[model samples]
Target: MSRERFVVHLPVLATDLAAAKRFFFCDRLLDGRRRCPLPADHVGECGPSRHR
Candidate 1:
């Protein structure tokens, strides 16, 4: 087995690696095998983004 095979990829920002390291998704399990599409640190509800 190659060492590369053990590497795991994660979502990260290029400009702010420090912040990206701490970033997290809502990942809340929703109905019908769906997940809450929001950031873990989102201010509003834990659903789709509201259009202004």
Candidate 2:
């Protein structure tokens, strides 16, 4: 059997989501590729958390 490879993108909390999004949008448009949308949960102020 053969296995396939995949990529995982961790979401960074967006303290400045609007600005971050504008930068990313322009980047993607200039690069000529569309990517997955950012989730709403990651927006706003970010703080450290314990993930288990």
Candidate 3:
């Protein structure tokens, strides 16, 4: 197998990333398919962005 480089733009902002992740990855968006972009043990009151 070989790797190729690609450049795809999402045209999004900081706030947009949060919204998209929530809407697409969160269980509330899909049919009970829960996902977290951040680590499971990393969640706190600060939020995802602050976790990183």
Which prediction has the highest TM-score against the true structure? 1
Residue-level lDDT of model 2, residues 1-52, one tens digit each, is 9667687666666679675564342112212344434333444333333243
Query: lDDT by residue for model 1 over 1-52, one digit each (tens)?
Result: 6333353667656567556634656778777656676766668667774554
Cα displacement (Å) at residue 8, model 3:
1.0
Whole-model Cα lDDT of every candidate shown, in order: 0.63, 0.43, 0.40
User: Rank order by TM-score, top first?
Assistant: 1, 2, 3
Query: Which model scores highest in lDDT?
Result: 1
RMSD of each: 8.2, 12.5, 12.0
Q: What ranking of all candidate models by lDDT puts the best one first?
A: 1, 2, 3
Q: What is the Å distance of residue 28 in model 3 from its true position?
A: 25
Candidate 2 — which pairs collide? none
TM-score of 3: 0.20
lDDT of 3: 0.40
What's the number of clashes in each of the models? 0, 0, 0
Error (Å) of candidate 1 at residue 13 is 8.5
Candidate 1: residue 10 lDDT (0-100): 71
